[model samples]
Target: MDKKNIKKVVLAYSGGLDTSIIIPWLKENYNNCEVIAVAADVGQGSGELEGLEEKAKKTGASKLYIADLKKQFVEDYIWETLKADAVYENKYLLGTSFARPLIAKRLVEIAQAEGADAICHGCTGKGNDQVRFELSIKAFAPNMPIIAPWREWNIQSRDEEIDYAEAHNIPLKITRETNYSKDKNLWHLSHEGLDLEDPANEPQYNKPGFLELGVSPEQAPDKPTYVTIHFEKGVPVSLDGQKLCAVDLLSQLNKLGGENGVGLADIVENRLVGMKSRGVYETPGGTILYHAHNKLEEICLDKDTYHYKQGIGEKFAELVYDGKWFTPLREALSAFVDSTQGTVTGDVKLKLYKGNIIDAGVTSPYSLYDEEIATFSADDVYDQSDADGFINLFGLPLKVQALKKLKLGK
Candidate 1:
């Protein structure tokens, strides 16, 4: 907490009220040190980035760094999650959860370049993001000092933050009544706060400023929509025969899937810090990708490998959710995922309608589903008489237990 020796501090600035206030607060409290702001553009869009440099300057930052991380965000972080088939608690796509590490990494880079004595963030102490940011910083740059203003400052509530912004002449994106905590990027949009904190309360999508991305299922189109997703080596390559880039492919899929009301999940998941919080997320493209990828895995992977890979998927989700992104276990699990996906090249057709994903078709060159061997009809692919010995050996435990009971009774 010593600010006397600090000549400069680099802040992970979002241009939000909290981060806007931190720039001035650091200067005032940290012996008038220079504050450099870093706004990471991880596909939250150019709109949020617009006027960000000017805003940071106006808010007393000596310099501002706006790093465009959209393409890298999707290809490296989001697609990796897709490849692993990692879903937190069978629902969450880890949208905001995965974004923090990339942002923090850039924060450290800027901090080192700026020669700042410490790095700062606007995340509050209560939320999961604080953990995600700090843990990532520790993993990447262990010796760097992290200054969390919310954990240290006197501002205790969002109302106090707004008041501080007003007193300090800071421009903000939300007011007290209109604010709903939202995290947005190319992959998904997450809505929290307002009525969502209460588990008994149903969502009020009809209210203005309550929803994002697109319409809800009750407001979706009546007709069903079908699309084919082609994958090579576990990465989605095309949509409906059109070969698109990763970002464009996901964008097109989101538009189509959103129209059909493909994805909307409401869950109160357990956080790593021993608390359950409710969040409403809309991940249109991710839902579709998960289905197609899982379907390909079914036909491509063998019995034991497929079942065991399922366990690895769960562990991967946990590690990612817990912010253990730099660990060896995640890398080892990714290796297993990569090996299982060697034969996962195929296309899966899915029908989306009214918040449901239906499997329409699936085909793969390495599919183990031979109709001749699996059919019950008369065929020369296998002799039916050969099953007697196979069944006896397969059920040997049952046969031995039954014979033991018979001998005891006699």
Candidate 2:
């Protein structure tokens, strides 16, 4: 927390409102420390990254480093989350959750390389990103000092942040009326704050610019769109029939899923800081991928493994959401998840209609579904008489307990 010790600092900058102001704030408060801005290109699109270097320099940063993390983001973080089926609170897809650790790790690397005395982030004190960034930084550089401007600054609100930016002549792209906080990546786009803060307020999806990645279901086409996804050991390898790299595959799916209004979720989720927050997420490609992967698992994984994996998925979601990505438990859980995905290779066709994803077909080479055993009609593979014994043995404990209760009655 000592300002004198920080002669140089590496900042996780996005060229956003918070980070734009932090450049000058760091210089001012840290005795004119040099701020090296670091931006992670995790598929947030060119619009957010374009002209970022110029902006950072104009705002007082000595230099800007934009790391192209799209391939790693999709292949390493996004794919791993998909394989684990880890959805936070049965709603959130953990798009922003996992990206934080990756960005923070890069920040640590940049700090070490630059021989900086400290790491800085724009994440606010009340949100989850602070914990996520700090935890990942601590894991990589335990002794590195972290300066969170939001936690130390006098700015109380977004309005005040804008005032400070204007006072300092820092240009911003947002106005008071359009200042809804947002996070975007290849996996999803989340909209929060402003009108979304109230749980009762329905998302203004119909409003212009409210939904960036897609449209409202009401605005979707009447005709349904069918798409086929191919997976190899639980990783999506191709869309329809053409094989693609991880980034390209997900990009194509995002276009298809967004056009059909495939992934739109409005959720009130519990934050790691112990507060409920509402957010509307657009995860078009990710939603389709999850649906297809789960369908493939239905035929591939056994009942015991599939059911048990559901629990593991929930816990995994919690760990990812809580910023424990570098912890031993999360690594162990991911190992277990990987073991379950050995046979999760297949193709799943889905029909997307007005925000609903309907199953068209599913096929897997390692499918455990045996038609003869499952058939209700006459089947030699599974004898009907076997059910009589199974029922008797399965109900033995219940039957004995009932009999004992009957004997004790009067």
Candidate 3:
């Protein structure tokens, strides 16, 4: 690829220190190609988007394209993940990992529509997002050249990035000593870097940069707070019965869950590149959504279907984490997820307090639970005599092993 042939480039810019500097660097290195900055508003906040166009222009980007993808992000990506009960390493809600593909998809769309010659991003070579972003680009537009400045440039660290931004007059709001590096959206908020880079040291919740969602659990209210989440076909449609859109529902849940100091996680997770990194996450809405959706599935799904789907859920999490969202395997896994979610229409009641999700009640038209059969003092719904044959068949292998052991001893 000739540097002179590249006329224009679209960058997945975030208006952060790294991306702000990237606009100028791309222009400098790519034969002064026109750099168009595209920032996806995946419900990070309007505060971050405020004056973004002006910021881009001030930082030397020819233009800035801000796409409001909050609703679509939640409905398409977040809810799709929620339906599968997808959680990476049994803990992480994958806030940052999931957003890359959608952002890259939009980047591809914008690039094709604008007739841009190349696409670029600020992700470093070591991180998972570099893989996620590039893989999505390959999946959608394989011919488009990807310009990863971090992997190519001399900027070695965030400190060097800060120095570059300062020298170039990029107007960065962050400092080098901040305790955490955060990524936020409607689904979740992630915190990495700083002391979190050291696995042995636990995160300090009291620091200014460390806390955002709410007060720490130690400072949370003592009593439990109850909330009801309504789901229609596995999509969260409302809170406590009031109909709301995807963004609105997530907003309300974040507020409620945050007030109670819920949705905080400290995890040492395996990165896609096979390294373990410690991160603290705040996933208020995603926490509520995953738990509630699972509660609804408990009522809606049968035994074999439920157990088998659980296995699929684990695999689904792996595929998403590994940036296989646009692949055939992901589509097949989603098909299985969708099939299981057909009857998963219902509501879940939950109690939130001090970072805990507690069960209140779950109700669904397709509920598998039968109180009559499960009751200790039961009637014709279930016969006690049936247990003898059932246990005999179910435990045949164990019984035969015990008999063989006894015979050997005699």
Task: Tell me each candidate's TM-score.
Answer: 0.95, 0.99, 0.96
Candidate 2: which stretches are off by over 4 Å?
A: none
**lDDT (0-100) at residue 150 of candidate 2?**
90
| lDDT-sorted candidate list, best first | 2, 3, 1
Model 3, residue 258: C-alpha shift (Å)? 0.7
Off by over 4 Å in 1: 405-410
lDDT of 2 by residue, 1-410 (tens): 77898999999999989999999999999999999999999999999999999999998999999999999989889999999999999999999999999999999999999999999999998999999999999999999999999989899999999999999999999999999899999889999999899989988888988888888899989999999999999999998899999999999999888888889999999999999999999999999999999999999999999999999999999999999999999999999999999999989999999999999999988999998888888877877788999999999999999999999992
Ranking the candidates on TM-score from highest down gives 2, 3, 1
Once all C-alphas are superposed, what RMSD does model 3 give against the true structure?
1.7
Clashing pairs in 1: none
Give the per-residue lDDT of model 3 (tens digit) for 247-324: 898899988888788888999988888888888888877888889998998888899998998889889889889888
Give candidate 3's error at residue 130 in angstroms. 0.7
**Model 1 TM-score (2 dp):** 0.95
lDDT against the true structure, per candidate, is 0.86, 0.94, 0.86
For residue 290, model 3's alpha carbon misses the true position, in angstroms, by 1.1
Q: Alpha-carbon error at 60 in model 2, in Å?
A: 0.6
- TM value for model 3: 0.96
